[model samples]
Target: MTRVIVAAGGGGDAVAAVMVGAALYGAGEPAVILTYAWDRLLVDPVPGPRGPGDFTGLRPLTPHVLAVPAAAEPVAPAGSTLPRLAAELPHTFALIDPHHGARGIARQVGELVDQLAPESVDLLDVGGDILARGDEPTLKSPLGDALTLAACCRVDAPVRLLVAGPGLDGEIPADVLRDRLGAPVATLAPEHVEALGAVLDWHPSEATAMLAATARGVRGLCEVRGAGLAVPLTDEGPTVHEAGLEEALERNELARAVLDTTGLAEAERHSREICGFSEIDGERRRAARLGARAPAGLDPDAALARLDRFQADARARGITHTTFRRIAEVLGLNGTLRLDLRDLLLARRPEQYEAPLWRVPAEV
Candidate 1:
């Protein structure tokens, strides 16, 4: 049976989805993953959601397509680790454009469904935030998860919502998720945790700590910088909960409204309207406006020089966190500029780079 597993929150969720998909479908089973290129600004510097424009060599199944990399070719724009799974796993990775929003993404999902004819579609959320009601004070990045959830609900195929590593994202607590969705259908095995840890080694993600903790059988409160909160992970470890999509929607009024959203913009607007802030996306835009520009494709020396200057300026202004996207835009660097910026900064001043994707001024 053809199965499509989508990373509901993008970034590490995509990576985690691969492991979960493998566990459910059996190793070597050909499963397709639908994930977005948008990672935490710490992981990717670019602001806003990425589109097909950010990728290379994606075989277009339709005008709006879900693409896997051509062989080992890079699928995402140079910096993102979303498609890095292409090298590790035998499964196909299909990217859904964040720019298209929910309506457009739903269209893409429909197209893929027609072409692949997958018997099951699983929307995999790394954290339990997918169950949030938008009023969760700790919710940082809710738009993407909500949009993907809405899109999956829109699809004709029966979509199962799988939440793994509850409270890991620092949004909704694990207890809240279990209370809402009932007991988990499955818990991650050592093999699954090993696979996730292997992928984390290649691409260091904010989600790594939670997975690592889960794997080691650590429980209780955990601190994830991305979440900005010390959330609780149950002692049970990385368990996977299965809930009917309708049951999930009924639990969260915000999600129900999201289901009615016409597009991504609408979904985002709804979030901002309710929460009174755009969270990380807002921060990215604010930071990018003050971005420093260097040349696109700068050599190592030039890139380091730019980073030095940027850090100096940030220190002068007492700016604690500056993302790669802002740096890339300011530098006027094109194509993998974030990757270049990240590499140079990390190599030259590893101390300046902090958790969750930031080039911090040394002082503060």
Candidate 2:
């Protein structure tokens, strides 16, 4: 079903509106209609040529279009007397306001919706400046009540109140929101603006909620995948390859495996060069022989320590290591460091170890 997102107050309101629009578009929905209300004083006057005989200075304009809508063909405002502009941009839409009070503005928006009856509509009400006085209620308590009532009466589709910034004050409390709205009430994060560029690619429509949920879910998964590859360190260092380090290294085929997955030909060549300099194969063979002779006394912890020392030596020889924390988290590592060593073996470059194992694209 198509849903209407109503953004009430602050900079966060704008962010929420943009996100909601992007989510809908990502779901392959039609363009959304965005309407913002501000105090009359903040509204700029439309400039015109002044006549020599005119006595009054430039008259204050009631409402002005701050931004054109982002749509193929924007619907003109009801009872518009101005000339219609041609649609030249993909995200084009209209900016409109009522010359009267807040109630009058709401009525006008309601009338517009009634006229259009779009499959879905979203009303983003960025709260007016509190310093200014007008017939429209302040965004805190009264405005919230008015909007709730308006949505209940006017819009037949799902209506959501996206409250952010200071406007959230005196409105519904967090605990009460679920009982009151009978739907989800989400908070807007201040950092959302950083992702605006990625977000604009999305188009708003009926399935906006689903798109948002999916994006959030995928990000969570990626984080889980990245966290699984971290090797734990103890006071004595690594605890896995002390006694049979050489044999374990040969059996695991770490070098060959890393070269295969990373897809970095240059890095693979570098690793091979480093391996030759360190004589890793010969060292592993000697360790394996020693391990075989002392098999009865071999300690797993000591073996791990030896592996740690080997890794340190490799690092000292200018060998780079790539850690993939984010990809591990996304892979759902349950605090376990049991990584599939094959991934590292196949990686051609150290950086390839950090790359995501799964091919999920990042969306804001």
1-364 in candidate 2: lDDT tens per residue? 2333333321223334554454333323334333332211111111111111121111221232233322222122111111111132223223333222233334434554555465655544322111111122221222222222232233344333332221122222223322222222333222322234433222111112122222333111211111122211111110000111122123222222332222223323333443332222333454455445522332334433543453454345433332232322222221122233223323423332222122222210
Give the per-residue lDDT of model 1 (tens digit) for 1-364: 7788888877677777766775777666677788877654544566666666666666766667756663534333335665567766666777787565677778878887888898788898877788887787777777788788878888887788888877776677666777766577777666765655456533544454465456556544433343123445455547777866776666555566667656566666777777666655585774575355443566778766766676576556545544454556556554455566667767777875443245445553
lDDT of 2 at 293: 56
Worst 10 residues of 1 by lDDT: 220-229
What TM-score does structure 1 among the candidates reach? 0.74
Best by lDDT: 1
User: After superposing candidate 1, which stretches have Cα over 4 Å from the reference?
Assistant: 70-78, 226-228, 260-262, 289-364
TM agreement with the true structure for every prediction: 0.74, 0.30
Off by over 4 Å in 2: 1-6, 10-14, 24-28, 37-93, 96-98, 123-172, 185-195, 198-364
